[model samples]
Target chain A: MKNILFFTGRELTVEEMQEPIPDLHHFAVQPGVSDEPKCQRCGNETNFSSHPCARCGKECLYCRNCIKMGKISSCTTLYRWTGPEPDVPKAAGILHWSGTLSPGQKTASDNVLQAIQQQKEHTVWAVAGAGKTEVLFAGIATALSEGRRVCIAAPRSDVVRELAPRLQNVFPNTPPAALYGGSPDRHTYSPLVISTTHQLFRYTAAFDVMIVDEVDAFPYTFDHSLQYAVQKARKTESALIYLTATPEPSWREDIQSGKRDATLIPARYHRQPLPVPSMKWCGNWKKSIVPPAVLEWVKTKEKALLFYPHIETMEKALATLKAIDSRIESVHAADPLRKEKVAAMRRGEVPVLLTTTILERGVTFPGVDVAVVGAEDRVFTESALVQIAGRAGRSADCPTGEILFFHYGKTTAMVQSIEQINEMNKLGRQKGLLDT
Target chain B: MNRCLLCENGTEVDSWRAFFGAKAPPLCEVCTASFNRLSGPCCHVCSRSLEEDGECTDCQSWRKSIFHSNVSLFHYNEAMQDVIAQFKYRGDYVLASIFAEKIRTEAKKAACDLICPVPLAPSRLAERRFNQSEALIVCAGLTAAPLLGRHESEKQSKKSRAERMNAVQTFYPTGEATGKSVLVIDDIYTTGATMRLVADALADAGAASVKSITIARSGS
Candidate 1:
C-alpha cells in the first residue's frame, strides 16, 4: 500500500481505511485545535474553540479560533503521500528577472543567500517597501540552482497572492505553485511553492528553503502553531527566513540578546524616511466624524482608507462618511462584494473606503493618505497602528503621504506607532541609508 | 477553566458569578440574557410555552395521543441551537452535563417506573460512541434503562420540520413493558416527532403510561 499521511496525524480506524495493503501506515494526528488541527494561517492555537462547530458537527477539538483563513476543526482532514518521497520537485530553471536590487537590498539579499546556503535560520527585518521580496530572488535562485525545494509563506493570502506572480516572473523557468484555502493548485507539487502559511498543514519535512513574509502580521505574530507548522513543514537542515516590515519588540530583544541572526533594512527601496503618523483629537469619535478635518485631508489625496474599531460602528461611520464623497464605499471580511470594492479602490474609482482593521496589513495603495477614527480603541494595538501607517507612501512614484490619527483621546498605541516609525527613520539616518 | 458554553467572553468568577441564585445559568451575562427558558403558562400536554392559558394546537391532539404529557427546560433559541449542536452533532458529550443538571432539577415531575432514553441506531452509536440523550440521563445521576430500540433509519437532523413532524413511527420496545409507567428523555424536542414515535412504541408495548422530557424544545 502507498504510504499516506492524515491531517492532524490521527490513528485511522479500520473502517476509514480504503484498503490495508502491504506497507500501509497510519499516523496518529495530534489532539489539539491549535496543536492538532493547526490553523493554516497565523498558527495560533488558543483554547477558544470550546464552542461546538457547525461544520463537522463534532465538538471538533481542533482550533476554533476565528480567522480570515478558515477555521480548523477535528473533522477537517488533510492527506499526504508518505508511501515514498515523490522524487523531489526537481526542475530546470534559470534566473530571468531584469530588475536589479538597490545597494541595501543587494547587501540583505547576499546575507540571505549566504544564510540559506549554510542551512541557518535568519530574519530579514526590512521596512515597508524596502524591496523585501526582491531581496529573496537571489537566495531563491541559488537554492533552485542547487536543486533544493523552496517555499515562501505569509500569514495573509494577499502576501502569497502578491509574491507568487513576482517569484514566477523572476524565475520563469520554475513556476511557483500558489496554495491557499480554495486554491486550485492545492494538490499540484512544484519545485518552487508560494502559499499562505495555513496551507502548510498538509506538509511534513517537505521544503529545503522556507521564507515567511509578514512574520509579525495577524494570526502569525502571536500564534505559535504557525511557527510549529513552519518547523514541521521543513527539513531539519532547511533554512527558515522570517521576513517582516515591522519586527515585534521581542524579536529586537532576541537580536540584542544574540539569540537570533537578523538583517535590519531600516530604509525603503527609494531611501525615503518612513512617514510618521500625526494624531489629531476628534473628540469622542464614537459619537461623530469631524467632517472638516477629514475632508481637508481627503481633499488632498485621490484615495484614502478610513479605519474603524468594529463592524457595526464602521457601518454607522460609513453612512456618515458618505456625505464627504458619494464615491465612498465600505468593505469588511463578511462583505460579499469586498473583492469588487477593493478592486474599485485600486482602479482609483473610489476616493475613500471605510473599513475595519481587516485591511491593516498585506494591502498597499501608493501615496494613499490614511487615518484612524478611534485610535484609542484597544483593537488598534501598537503593532497594528504601525502596520496601518506602513500603508502610506508604498509606491515609488508617491513616496510620501499623510498618515493621521483622528482620536477621541491620544493613545499609547498612537504615540508608540509614531515612535516606532521615527526610531526606524533615525536608525536609517544613523546608517546613512536615508535620503534626508 | 469554566468557559461559558454560550458567549466565550467572560471569566467564570466575576462574569458568571455576578448572576447568582435561580438566575445563575451556566453562561456568561451576555449569553444569560439570550437564554429562552420555558417559564410561565405552558401547554399541559407538550409543555410548550404559550401566550394564552390553554393547550397549543399540537398538544390539543393529546386526546388522540399515547403520551400523557411532556416537559422541556428551555425554548430552543440560537443559544440552544449551539448547545444542542455541540452535544448531538459535535459529540461534545460534556455539554450534556449542563442540561443534565437542569433536567435533574425538573425530573421531580417525571416520577415513573423507569427512565428510557430515545434509542439511537447502532451505526451512529459506533460513530459518535454515545447517544446524546443517554449521556444526559447518565450524567443527571439517574439510572438510564434501555426500554426501547430502533432500526437504522434516516437521522432526524437531515429532515425538515414538516418531515420530522410527520415522520413515520420507527421506535419499538426492546422488551415487554407489561403495564409499567415509563419516561422518555431526549436532547431536543423538534416538532415532537421522535417523542411521539417513542411514546407510541411504549404504549404499544402495553405500558400503563408514557411521559417525555427534553432539555430544549423548538420554539420556532
Candidate 2:
C-alpha cells in the first residue's frame, strides 16, 4: 500500500478509499451534504462534465473549486475519528527563547494569549518591523503547553521559509514541520506546523490554533479560496489570530462589533517612527533617468533604491544611470540576478539599485534611502507604498532615512501612504513609544 | 488550496466526478474549457489533425523503422502550450497529475504488459528533477518500467524538426524485452523522430510490438 499523503490533518489518496465502518458512534453532520456533489469542505457546488471521467468511467460532477487540492466529488467520502482521546503530554519548555519582549510587545503578547484562551479572533495591528512574530511566540507557547495543535500560515512561500526555521528554533523540543508546494517535510507528524495558506486546503478542522501572518499581503487578501482554506483548516472553536502590518478596514469593523479583540502595535521594535515619504512631481518619469531631485538624493545617501513601476522603464533608467555610476544595477520580478543585485545594494557596493514592488515587503536595507520613480502608477498601492517607505529607517543604527515619491502627479495611494505613516507616527508618539 | 495554475483566479467552481474521482484539476472552468482537443480528421501515424485527409507523408518513412500508430489527447494550441510548459518547465507536479487519469485511460486501450515513458537525459534530469511522462504514469495508478535511457543531448524544444529527426541517436533500450507489447509514453509527440528511434531500439531488443501515446501533438 502506498503511504497516505497526510497533509495538515486530512488523509488523501490518489485512488478510491473505503474502510470498513467500525462499530462506533457516528454523529450526524450537515444533512443532505453529500447530495448534488456539494463540497462541504469549501462550501462550493459540484461541476458537471460532458466528457466521460477517466477514473470513474462515467459522466460525473466533481468540485472544481477545491480540485487543486485533490478533488472532492459527490462520491467522495470523508471520515473522522470520534473515539476516546488519548492523554496528551503537557510538554514543558516547548519554547526556549532567551530574548525578552519589550513593554509594548509584552502587552500585545498577553492579549494574544487571552484571545487564544477564549478561542476568539484577534489581530495584531502592528506596523512594519514591530516584531510581530515575537508577539505570537508567547501565545504559541501557551497553546503548545496545553497540548493544542498550532499552525502558522503565511501567503507567500518566502515568508513561510523565513518563519519555519525561526519557529523551530524557538520551539526546540517540538520540531515544527513546514508545508509548501514541494515541501519535503510533508510526512513529519508534528504538533506544530508552519505552512503557506494554499497548503491549508488539505486540512480539515485540524488546528486548534491558526495564526495567519501577513494577512493583508498579496494572494491571501485578494484570494477568497485562501481565506476559505484557513477557515477549513481550523477546528470549529479555534482561535483565529491575524498578524499584519496593515490591517484592512473590515478588521476594524469586526473589532467594533466585538467579533474580534485586537492588539494594535503601532511602534517599531526599536521605538522609531516610519519614514514619511516626500512627493515630487517629475513629469513622465519614464523618459527621465536620474532626475535632478533623485540625483541629489542619491548623491547624499550612502545607498538607495529607485523603484519603478515597470521593468522596461527600469531597464532604460538603469542603462542611463550606469553611465553616471558603474555600480548601479536594477532588479525586477523576473530578474535572474535579483539576489546578487539586492546583496550588492545591502553591502553599499551598489550606490543606487532599481527595483519593482517585488521587494516592497520583508526586505530591510539599513539606512538606505528609497525613491519611487512612478508613485502614481496603480502598481504602487497604499500598502505597497507604506512597505517601500518601511524599507527606510528599519535599523536602529540609522532609524531615520529619506523616502522620496517621484511621480507625474500625486496619486491617492501616495498621499495615503504618507498619511498612514504620519498617523502611525502620531499614534506612536501618543502612546509615548517614540522619542521626541 | 491554490489559485488555479492556468488562471491565477480563486473563484469557486463546481465539483465533477473527475474533480473528486482521483487526480483533480488544478485549473478553473474557463481555463479547462480552453483545452483544444485533437478533434477533426487525424493522421493515423502521428494522430495529428490532418488538414485534408488520411495519414500525411511524415508517416510514410515509418515502414523502414519499428514505427507504429500514435494517439494524442489534445492539439498543441497556445493554451495547451502554456499548460505543458508549466508542467514540464516550472515543475508544477500537481499539473502533471491532472493528466494522469487521461493518460491512464489512453493507456488502457493498448493493454500492454509493460509501460514505458521516454526518459530524460542525465543533464536534463538533474535540472528538472523529474521526467514529466513518468509523473503522468504515477498519476495513472501504475509504475512504468525503466526500460530506456538517453545520452546528454540538446533538448527537443530547442531543435527544429529536421534537426530533431537527424539529431544523434540518444535513446537506447536499457532493459530486456521478450514477446511483450510495449507502449511508449511522452508529454508531447513533436517530430516523431525521437519516438521512431525509441521504437527501432525497442524492436531490436526483441519487443513483440511498439506503439506510443502522448498528451499533445504538434501541428503538422
**Residues B70-101, candidate 1, lDDT per residue (tens digit)?**
88888888778877876676556556667767
Question: What is the Å distance of residue A8 in model 2 from its true position?
Answer: 7.3
Which ranges of candidate 2 are over 4 A from the true structure? A1-8, A15-37, A40-50, A63-88, A253-259, A289-292, A299-301, A336-344, A347-349, B1-5, B8-82, B85-187, B190-220
Error of 2 at A40 (Å): 4.9
lDDT by residue (A1-436, candidate 1, tens digit) is 1223222221222333345423435343432234454553335545444434434455555443433233334554433334444333334347888887877788889989998999999998887778888898888888988878889988878778878888778788787889988987664557788888777755767788999888888787666667777887888989989898777889879976889898888889888888999988777666665446665766566688988889888887667767767788889987989889989989999998888998888778776889988888999998889888989998879899888888877878779888988989999899888888
Candidate 1 local Cα displacement, residue A101, angstroms:
3.1
Query: For candidate 2, what is the interface RMSD?
Result: 10.4
**In terms of lDDT, which candidate is strongest?**
2
TM-score of chain B of each: 0.85, 0.88
Instruction: Indicate the residue-level lDDT of B25 in model 2.
Output: 53
Q: Judge candidate 2 at residue B142 and give its lDDT.
A: 80
Q: What local lDDT score does residue B37 receive in model 1, on the 0 to 100 scale? A: 84
